[model samples]
Target: MAKCDACGTTILFGGKRMGDQRYCNDTCAGQGVLLNRVRQIPDGDVVAFANQVHSGNCPKCSGQGPVDVRDSYQVWSAILFTRWKSTPHILCRRCGVKAQAGDLAISAVAGWWGFPWGLLMTPVQVGRNIWSMAVAHNPNQPSDALLRQARLILAQRSLQDGRSQG
Candidate 1:
């Protein structure tokens, strides 16, 4: 058995292979690619790149004080299967609040149809969205996860620019 490169899950059988790295699924493969890109950036440069992103405008609304927010929503069908999704967004406080409101509404409406998992996850996701909204109320600085994502974005852009010039 081989351990997944992105997430350390024991792979019992066939798995997606990218070069020498093996991943359990497509999502893991995509994450592995991103991890590789992030690794290309030097450790000393991460803080500088994050600072640059912090000073820049929000990618969505072009507003200041952009912060990272992740909201989870759940949906279940036929008392058998449950689907949950967590989406991350980098937006100003106003935009983040709007997005969280949508997630909250959706989770409240569609998150309680299935079995034990749906019952268990619905309230949790709803509370999580509420918490995210409360945190977004005071957008002072970018969160650490936001800073890391910013560094990754800047590093990817720089690599693309270098490739284009060469």
Candidate 2:
């Protein structure tokens, strides 16, 4: 068994491989990632760049092993609906339009159970929040009516896909 160079944890099967495979899992892997992203430190001559990462806890479900969104319809369905990352703008494939990011929350909201609930939450609700945030952030992007229609389209698409497959 290979031991992680950083944490000394035994590298399990499927853990990412690097230089004989350090770090037992992605959390540890992130430490190295964060370290690398910060180029300079100290001496009063340093600025930290923003670290962009998918918000919320690990989305993978573990049972019998680690099951990812790709493995099950339910998981994949959630992934299809969930926003992977926040961007200042996104390219819309439908109309070939570029959209400015709205006032969407930068972090995923947690439910009463202390778990990431945004993915499990309704896409219409989430999408509405995103659309509202978007229009509020930049009125130049699209009208609220147009954004609402887009959100409904996305939510409906997800529902249709889920029903068709699951």
Candidate 3:
């Protein structure tokens, strides 16, 4: 039996056979994949907009905010999915806004829609619409096209709002 070179544990599953294989189980292998995927997405910034129940521009919405959420198994699954999906959200300690892995996934799609200059608009726009639905006690089914439109509109409005503020 081939041994896991790092931990010296006996590897139960057959090694990739391509030569040097290290991890003993799928867990370690998956960890490597997760790390790589995270590196592909931008870090340290998040998208946010007005929520239906809370549109008063509270401290969380004032002058931008920093936020982060757990990218666990369930959340990641929601984000990678292509159609309408919902998942629990995590909030930033500083900002009261909530977002899930799926939320981040939508943002990635909107942000990189184009080359040279990816629009910073998809996730926030979709989030706003979803929030509205949440407040109205309606179940908002997220779609690819609708999400795209929401992102575009949010990007434009955000730019306009910024310019007006300047």
Of 2 and 3, the candidate ahead on TM-score is 2
Model 3 clashing residue pairs (backbone): 122-151
> Which candidate tops lDDT?
1
TM-scores for the candidates: 0.75, 0.22, 0.21
Better of 1 and 2 by lDDT: 1
**lDDT, model 3, position 141:** 30
After TM-score superposition, what is the CA distance of residue 133 in candidate 3 from its true location, in Å?
A: 31
Error (Å) of candidate 2 at residue 48 is: 12
Listed per candidate, the RMSD to the true structure in angstroms reads 3.3, 18.4, 17.9
lDDT by residue for model 2 (3-93), tens:
7655777766756655544677887775544443333233122111101111112222211211111100111123234433322222222
Residue range 1-166, candidate 1, lDDT tens digits: 7999999999998999999999999999988877888888776677666655556777788887544544545444348677777787766677767877898888788888878878888898888888877754334555677667766786668767878999
Residue 60's lDDT within candidate 1 is 81
Instruction: Show the colliding residue pairs in model 2.
Output: 102-133, 102-134, 103-133, 103-134
Q: Residue by residue across 1-166, what tens digits does model 3's lDDT show?
A: 7775435677787743223446666665544344333344332111222231122222444533222221211111133332333432222322323443345455555444533233324454455445533432112232232233334445555555767999
The models' CA-based lDDT, in order, is 0.75, 0.34, 0.38
lDDT of 1: 0.75
For model 3 the TM-score comes to 0.21
